[model samples]
Target: MLGAMSIDLVDLVYRFRKEEKEQHQRIEGVYWVTDLTRCPLKRTYEFKYPELTAKDVFSPVFIMGDLAHRGVESLIKEFFLDAASVEVEGSREVSLPNGRKVIVRGRADAIIDLGDNSKVGVEVKTARADLGIPQQHHIDQVRIYNWLFSLSYSILFYVTPDRVTQFEVRDSVDEEEIIERITSTTYPRYPWECSYCPFSVLCPHKKAHDDRHR
Candidate 1:
């Protein structure tokens, strides 16, 4: 009887692992940034909001204002997806060079069942008017998602509060430029990042660094 019980327990563990894998397959998103860098700024800002010198400029208002905007993005993207969704496959956690885990999280704004003309990934960007149709930076972001998720193609949606702009990625669009831009940053700035940029105030790169003995 004890031997039979051990077998049952092993079977249960196997079933549990299978179920977990299936559940992960059903959800299409990557949480890789978590492994990249430990974002102390977000933690510090949330904790010391009251004592912050820039409290007035940075308020809970930013949070409140984005709620509805985020809602619109969700609704539109879900509609585009119809019902079925894509799932993240591997490397959700990206480890940064500094040995910190920068939690990277992303989902398809919408996944379209293309039938025969199906594309792999779709990205939705909310932005103001007069913005360019598609930039190298935007392409790089989408390409990373597509590559990581094992998707063949990606679509870029630039949506405003009123209108929607769409662009598709193909093979011949100077992909090298996009990759280069992603790898190099000659001019980095603050006050423009969404919430994830790590080098806002404490980055020595923002100032001039002169290394002698070259």
Candidate 2:
């Protein structure tokens, strides 16, 4: 009976130890557009309990996303604006009201020539499945690039294992709102967000799920 109940202890402990250091970083000292959109509580936990919340587990989906991005990025160089045109690091800097420095930057996957003097920014993403066009977080990412470039529009591509979908979003990301969010305190902030957060169990604002559904 004891043997039947036994699980792979080595893998379990490896996973536990591996997760201890993943995504562990200082929050307030720096910021990314994701922190403002992907549940502020996630950022809160990463900052507040960096050790406990880090998850270093291997995710094939994440690996696929990376491979997809790299493949697409290489292809777009020949047809559109080359990789040389984009900045990868947080090279562009924005100064806050309190003299705090924040950098605004992302590796604009590509820039498309509109044939006129104008151009559109591109962001490529790979997801396990199609959530929908303009998924909020990915939108936020591209919108930030648009804001930085002050372009009239941007494109988002979601490549899943099954298919690819594209969306053209207008340059409407609120720079002030983003600034406000980063300055504000971190809480889970939204119940829906908690349902998807890794730190939901430890989150003070995490909503109780209905056991009946389970």
- What is the per-residue lDDT of model 2 for residues 1-214, given as tens digits with 9 covering 90 to 100? 5766868865765565465334334545566656666666576577677655444345555545655777877777756644224324333566778988886544566776665667677788776566454566677777777776666788887787777878998856676866776676645443356666677666667776542221
Cα displacement (Å) at residue 197, model 2:
1.9
Model 1, 1-214: lDDT tens digits are 4565445654554455455435543121223322112322433333344233333233344333344345655675567655436433344444544454433344554455556645566665655452454755566566666645545677887656556777887542232332332233444322233233334455443444332211
Candidate topping lDDT = 2
* TM-score for candidate 2: 0.69
Please state the error at residue 182 of candidate 1 in Å: 9.5
- Native-to-model Cα distance after best TM-score fit, residue 127 in candidate 1, in Å: 1.4
Runs of candidate 1 exceeding 4 Å displacement: 1-83, 86-106, 115-119, 161-163, 171-198, 207-214
User: With candidate 1 superimposed using the best TM-score fit, by how many Å does residue 89's alpha carbon deviate from the native?
Assistant: 7.5
Poorest lDDT segment (10 consecutive residues) of candidate 1: 28-37
Model 2 misplaced regions, further than 4 Å: 1-28, 52-54, 81-87, 90-101, 112-117, 189-191, 208-214
RMSD of each: 14.5, 8.2
